[model samples]
Target: MTKNRWDNGITHHDGEAREFISTYFSQTGRRVLILASAGFDLRSTAVSRAIAQTGVTCRGIFIREERPNADQALRARADKNAEQLKIVVPDSKVVFIDIFDPVDQAVVGARRLTRDVLPILAEGEPPTDIVVDASALSIGISFPLVRLLDNLYGQKPGTPNVHLFVTEDPHQDDQVKPDHAERPMWVPGCDGDAGSDLKSKSIRLWIPQLVLYRTEALRRIHDFVDATETCPILPFPARDLRRGDVLLEHYRTLLIDTWEVDPRSYIFAAEREPLDLYRTLLRIDDARQKVYGQQGGSLMVLSPIGSKLLGLGALLAALDRDFPVAYLETVSYAAQLGAMKNLEPDDWPIVHLWLSGVPYA
Candidate 1:
């Protein structure tokens, strides 16, 4: 088997992440290109502010989700963040790409990004490093963007390295809810040929990251996948000791009655450590491959419906294994009225992962 790319990946959290941003540009001759969300979420411009403090010469592509029935307060907040992002990265060429089609409600983010941004990355004097702030950008957008950049520039020598950044706070995530969810669909660029019937002979093992308030999304995806086996990923050693237990109880009915997931198949990964989840998934897939390699074979399908940290881990594993990432695209996210009322800005810790770059070379 080929070695896992992120077996010893570079990652930083909290103060270390801030310090890395402060010194990264000064130490290396790299021009950075940051793609982040310009949403109502407080952490939308978090990474931008960190990079600005480093005096890095970089550009940004701020994603703005277009919602028709969005709350006025939330819309105002999004607008404010966009302005703040512009102020923080004053010298950089910044662009705003609107996601979610207004008419049919079909996710056109991947298509729009390919049309508007891919050319820029391929042009002369492209950025030497690409950073994606996945804190606020929905998985529908961030996953495809990261996959595209990696396929385009990360795998080759003298090409830009791809990095993922996020501000993680499970409490904050629990407060926000996705409303008006649409039917489940395969994430663009991470489909792994799931639609083809040629793989019907292969045994399908579905891995889903469990999260609060995402029961419906999980159910939709589970029914869509109809996998032969189900392995649920839960966060352990979490900030809240009872977090994993609470999630298990919340999804007890679905796990027991609906999906019929085995208790032995539950995966416990650290909430703060993305690499832990990465290594865990790699081991499980390796064992399965060993047993089914010469047979009809086996397929691992992942559904990342949890925290951004866990989602990053699932994204990494899917990229390495070429598995399908199934997800439920939301029609519109519910406005946060008072859910984040008591939370302070510092509650969310900044997280960073350097997926590929000079360090690996």
Candidate 2:
């Protein structure tokens, strides 16, 4: 009988997981704000350590789900954990907010929490760079915060440099329910299946794991608020504050216009595997070269081998070229071709190279 090593009690980490976390910490430098829920664990501790090692200032805002004093056991555990974290990382900043209310209520509470906490932010400092760690929050709660941030502050320029990290929980894997085996199947033309043939098409959706924003961009968003009216649905008090809907509407308009005119403003990916990164770099390079034209084109390549090849190619191609030319990877030609529905045989030759795992030439 063959034995499965992992079937026992050993925890194994994948390279992609390590790479993702490393890349996240290495990428950001500004003040970091971590938003966590009651389920915070060792992963959060690891993240805090990584940030501290990077010499970046870090603050954690933990949302408590249990009532104080009523649940002594749970409260004690929570308090002990919070205390340990403080002792371990004494210099680290931490704040706790009660969120014992229901989901909708908690969401409103969080918004109000953010508003009230804004005053606690140091005065005269440029809006501290913010990073909301939504790995712990439910999608309902997490999505709202994301929408709020995106509405208030747009992405940082150059690279979407903000690091939004989500940690996958083991419990989450068990929560996925299998499809029902007894579910009825639909076939067309049969009396019972006539209308049943109208099956809903499965739509594949991709949500970005990380969202980075420029500090200035977020400040601009907050500045638009009037601070007089109470923002409804948000836990914050009603003062003469600008409506959340109005701010969000303006944000949507700006995002759409910016994306259409400047694809550089957004870096979206179905997944962030290394392969995807390589492909994205190639695509960007190709687009830049195309826009600039052959005469004045400058190639910027991110991959090490690609960069070396580009330098050599520029020299060799420079000698007998009819037009000034540079070869680089900004965008993957494969990805572009794949997006198209059909391809001519002529195009297949190039496409074949990509499909065969050959890097862009």
Candidate 3:
């Protein structure tokens, strides 16, 4: 197997926006195009900044859920966000996607993206580099499109890379409350339904989604892995201030002092959403060889990520690298004690995937 580079770590929200464009542009020598999902929050600053700094155009596929019972204020907030993005990002067009709709329906994001979004983004630019804001999108829309676009671009001789980006501000998320009582649920999306091998000493790295509520049960991950074997490895990007984040800090303390998990486990990856973590885990020599070689080996898997892009990353790692995938789905995530719900299968609107062809290596 060839060596893969894992470029990840935390940069201050404001500082990293401009940095992402300049750095990626220089490396790839390709124009930046952000394939992002819009939300009620004004977090699109990162996307706007990248466009302003690079002067490259962007086309977006915004997934807007049709929550009929949503408060008028919520609807207004979303409207304002949509308006703000257009104003901030030059030469950008946003395609509204209602992911809950059926494939034949007019509002289905997957269909719209395939029909309207891709053609515009592809026009003029033969290889437009994609910057996906996988931080907050329904798995229904995120998965199929990512698989489609990544492969669509990957097939061409000079296939432009589909880069991943995710941003989470505990400060903003904590303003709301969620219940602490959570139940662990398993996530689907594995090839062979095999049992996890807890005896392996080889690295079984875990990419956590959000540490909002499950801070306590995280230790149980060790129960699954042998004591001699590192049960649950926690990886967090640096440049984070845990002052207000009690649960996250608590877990960090446990990882370093109580659990004796190696310092190497705490990943200093892209603060918002960087594809590096997934790429690194996918390229792991031991797991890659064992799983890819189709040897009698099982790779450990855990994902608490809230971002669908991260979820896509997890799924890709599991499917391509041959790792067994599972999730600790909370018992009830009905916006319960400020619980930051982990990503799960049911949360996503759909499970089916649509791609033009197989992904390129």
Candidate 4:
């Protein structure tokens, strides 16, 4: 059996990490807080250093895990890294929280910091923002933290903005050849069937941290407690418009509605499954006349065979229609002209619509 090796430095793949860091740099001058777990502490010193270099006020909350000698050594390494970070990012600050501590205590500590520590740190400074580095923690706790912050500091129409940056591990490539060259891979829709050229593939070598949010537009997120209470079916924010109706045309007229204007909006990175499915549906709707029939009537009210052919398309369209704009904002932002190809065979129809770029009803 081959022994797996673990390394403590950042690894680059697919240009994702670079893009993520660039996004933060673009948003410089905002007050930013980084909530980091042990994994992030290990993997993202470079990122932290980069943030500091931007001259933005950045703070890091490090979550420590209790362990024996070996673990202690790793913790010590992190501490050393933190110390080094202070030199590189003289303005940046750090706080350590032990995970072995009780959950209630941890929550209390986090709340006290957000409510008390952070504000004081800001010292009535103008233009403050917060970003949670939740890559290491389970979504269970991380998701709730986001909700808690929103509730504690209710978002005024245009007040001090808080940004939450939750980072996740990048997909791994286990198919390297004996020579260690990356296996040939292409994002089908992105470059089409011809396959990405060698230069594009080589430049693509950076693991991406999906920017789960666009800071300025995050109004409120449903709390974890409420989500758990409902379970299986997630509870979405209530929409003012009646079901089956299109969003008011006035919404499209807003300045933010124009392509590329707003900087402070919240954008989420949705799981590929849901986004792909939604895209497929949109494509089916777009090509309906060629594939099925006319597109005038409600796609939902079609015959059984037609509906199945459409499959999850109608359902996804309904979600986009009725749900608050935030639900699909990420899909809208990350949406490339042909980003939805290469979906699993079963998900083909839904991916087609999602890539078709049709606006939801």
In terms of lDDT, the best-performing candidate is 1
Tens digits of per-residue lDDT for model 4, 230-313: 101110111222211121222223224432223332111123223333443344334433433332221211100011112222
lDDT per residue as tens, model 1, 1-361? 7699889899999999877877886556778787888888888877878776677678777778675677778888888888888888764444455556777766777888778777766554677778889999888788898888788766578877778899977887787888745678889999999878766778999999999888888888888998999999989889999999999999999999988888899999989889999889999989998999888788899998888898999999988888899998766666555777444444457989998877888
Alpha-carbon lDDT of model 2: 0.31
TM-score of each: 0.94, 0.37, 0.56, 0.37
lDDT of 3 by residue, 1-361 (tens): 5433222322223345445555645553456566665555435344544444555555444545443244465456567766766665655676765433444332244555566666776666554466666544444455546656655664355566566554555444544332222333233334123343432534444444545555555554444432332333223443354432444465666666776767454433343343544565655535545663544333456453443334554555554554544443221123322344343311212111111121333
Candidates' C-alpha lDDT:
0.82, 0.31, 0.46, 0.31
Please give, for residues 56-104, the per-residue lDDT of candidate 2 as tens digits. 5555555443322333443454465566546544543455544334443
Query: Would you give me the overall lDDT of model 4?
Result: 0.31
Candidate 1, residue 351: how far the Cα is off, in Å: 1.4
- After superposition, the stretches of candidate 2 with alpha carbons farther than 4 Å from their true spots are 1-30, 38-42, 66-73, 88-94, 100-107, 120-124, 127-129, 156-161, 172-361
Q: TM-score: which candidate is best?
A: 1
